[model samples]
Target: MTIDLEILHALSEAFGPPGDESQVRDLLRGRLAPLTDEVWTDVVGNLFALKRAKGESRGRVLVTAHMDEAALMVMQVGGDGLLSVRAAGKTEARGLLGQVVHLGPSRTPGVIGVQPVHLTPHERRQDLPDLGDLTVDIGVDSKDEAAGVVKRGDYAVPAAAFGRLGPLVKGKALDNRAGLVVALALLEGDYPCDLYIAFTAQEGVGARGARVAAYAVEPDLALVVDGVGVDELPDEDEPPPDVRLGEGPVLVLSDTRTLLDRGLSLRLQALAEAHGIPYQVLATRGETSDARGVQAAGAGIPTALVGLPIRYPHLPVSLAHPDDLEAAFRLLQAALSQPG
Candidate 1:
């Protein structure tokens, strides 16, 4: 399958932090409009595009790719033009320190500040700094001056530059954005089953958008695409020791919230082997995806989870192999073409 690097680049860089998904939705709407028969955006801002099956509906198949990434909300402008922020989701403060962040509307740029090492006391130097102790410097001198240009509640995210790093790509928001790209690619392909491509929102917060999207579509089969944590350490003693980057996409068996359907799991494994698509088995101890909330949507929807093998997931610089993305796209395309 030919991958569209342009689309992937655009999606990865687009701004959409949980509830604020309009910008990303607009980009997807334009790209998917020509490929799909119908396109609609729900009240919760979940973008759904449909390609009707040729004959009687075997069953609705929902493919979801979350549109939200970890971010921070501006809590207050400090007395010295510094911005105090509260975590919007599961972001680590250490990863954000010394990183550039983009503020709302005008796209104001700011750098996260930490006390200089020479000024820090020896005892406190080794301790990790808490979020409350950090501040964002936007080059202004006073809170009154800062307030003139920036406002409270504006979202802030890593202003990381996007580019390929060897075989892996490094960038912010690659976790779910890469999955969104895969879903759009599937929509643009020729699949046999009725397909609903749902670009969900608020996945960083309990898969809220997915819950509503699944409830609305009521699909017989649902596939949630996102990134899964992979161990890249030289030593093999990490908590999740099974998965690795460049191996392939993961067929998640179970996570904290849901387990894969037994029949679906076997079918996916068989399909991968028959088509020569690389795959790995994942057992997430605490993580969960939209699949959990989606499966419980009405009576119950059979669900499967496919994830790109990502290192340092949920961090600003997530890593994913291009081959894994292609493998995922192929699996979904083939599964939809099969008799349901």
Candidate 2:
């Protein structure tokens, strides 16, 4: 199947930060409508696309990719029009300083503010700025002016642009958006069982959407697509040693929060080897995806995880190899086509 680079680029740059996923939902709905038999959405804003198999019945298979990204929420507007924000999810405070962010609906632009280096005394130069002290400046003069354009509860996300750096794509939300792209690409092809593709919400927080989507779909088997960190920086001290970019998709043996399905893990590995898709094994001490929530839902659905290797995860700029995304797409497509 041919990859739609335009859709992929748009998806990577779409604005959706946790509880506010409407923008991305709209784009996904438009793209999946033609490929799916029935498309619907859950109350919590999870997008579900269903495709039935021909003739008799086979159990359903659920494929999920989270639609939310790490973000900040406006807590209060200071008297001087500086907006104080509360960090949402696992956001990096260090990466936030001096970064441009986008506010809700109106898409108002703001820049994270930091103390000028020239004004900092020598002794305080080594200190990292605290989240409480940081504010977002949108060029308003007072609280009333800022309030007219943005509200107290509005969400904020990094102002990211999608572009390719050689063979790799760099953007903000690729963590799971890349996975969403893979799910859409797979849907463009045929598979054996009935499929339920759920673009879930609030994954960075607690995997809330995955739980609800799993209960609603009730699949015999579930596969989660997401991004994992790769050690690419030179000065990094013995990087996570789990996954790396350009090594295809990483199959999780275990993560800090969940142990993978042993049988499913082995089968995925065998499938990758047989198909000649580049793959790597990743065991991490502190990472979890929507797969954890899916496995614990209801009577305990059998689950597996397919992760794209990412650089600088949870930051404003995250990186991934396009070939790794294609590998993940190939792997999941093969898995879904096989009999259980």
Candidate 3:
């Protein structure tokens, strides 16, 4: 499977900060319209593209990839003119220092202001600043001036351009946008089951959109497309972790919030091995994903999480390999082509 760089780049660069996901939604809507039998959005803003079964319906299958990215929300417009902001999702405070952020619908650019290291006390130099202690410099000097541009509750995202770095793709929001691209590719296929591809919203804050979506779709079985953390650094002395970039898409056995279906996990692993597609597995304990809502919806939906392992997840800019993304698409395509 060939990964579409154009679509992946567009999704990665789209401004979708949790509650405000219209930009990402609209982008997906246009692409999905021609590929599916029907396209629609639910109340919670989960965009659905249905590609009905070509012959006798085997069962209903739901595939989801979150549209929202970690962001900062403006909390106050201080009299001093710098806007106070807080994390809207799992944004890392340590990564926020000196990074540029685009605020609200206008996409007004701002830089997170950090105290100069030279001016800071020695002990405090290594301290990470809380979200409340940070300010965004949008080039204004008064509360009245700042109010004219941005207001409280407005969302902001880190500014980063999407591009390829040799085998790796780098950009903000690849945490799930890589998954979005995989889901998009899946939409082109005609499956044995009635396929519902959900471009879910507010996943970064929680698996909020998927909860409503799963109830609405009522899929018999499901597959969650997401991105997982890759914890490799060149300077680290320890042995490398099992999950790594360029390896392949990850088949998550279990995570903090949800225990994935065993049958589905085995099917994915077997399919990958049979087809000679490279793959990896993870049973990480700390992080969670949209699978939390999806697997638990409507009594129960047996769901599996297939993740694209990415470096620097939840940060302003993340990195992934094109081959890994393509492998993920192939694995999913293979799964849907076969009967449940």
Number of the top candidate by TM-score? 3
Off by over 4 Å in 1: 236-240
Score every model by TM-score: 0.96, 0.96, 0.98
In the predicted model 1, the residue pairs found to clash are none
Per-residue accuracy of model 2 over 229-275 as CA lDDT, tens digit each = 77766666565565678988999878888888889988999999999
Candidate 1 — what's its lDDT? 0.84
C-alpha lDDT of all candidate models, in order: 0.84, 0.87, 0.91
Worst 10 contiguous positions by lDDT, candidate 1: 231-240
Candidate 1 residue 228 Cα shift, in angstroms, is: 0.6
Please identify model 2 stretches exceeding 4 Å from their true place: 236-240
lDDT of 1 by residue, 1-340 (tens): 4557677788778777878888889998988878899999988889999998867767789999999888888999989888999887667787887888888877799999888899999998888888877788999999899988788999887887678999778788888888988888887666667889899998888889999999999888898898887766876554647888888889998998798787887788898999999999876646888888898888888888998888887777877788889999998887888837
Worst 10 residues of 2 by lDDT: 234-243
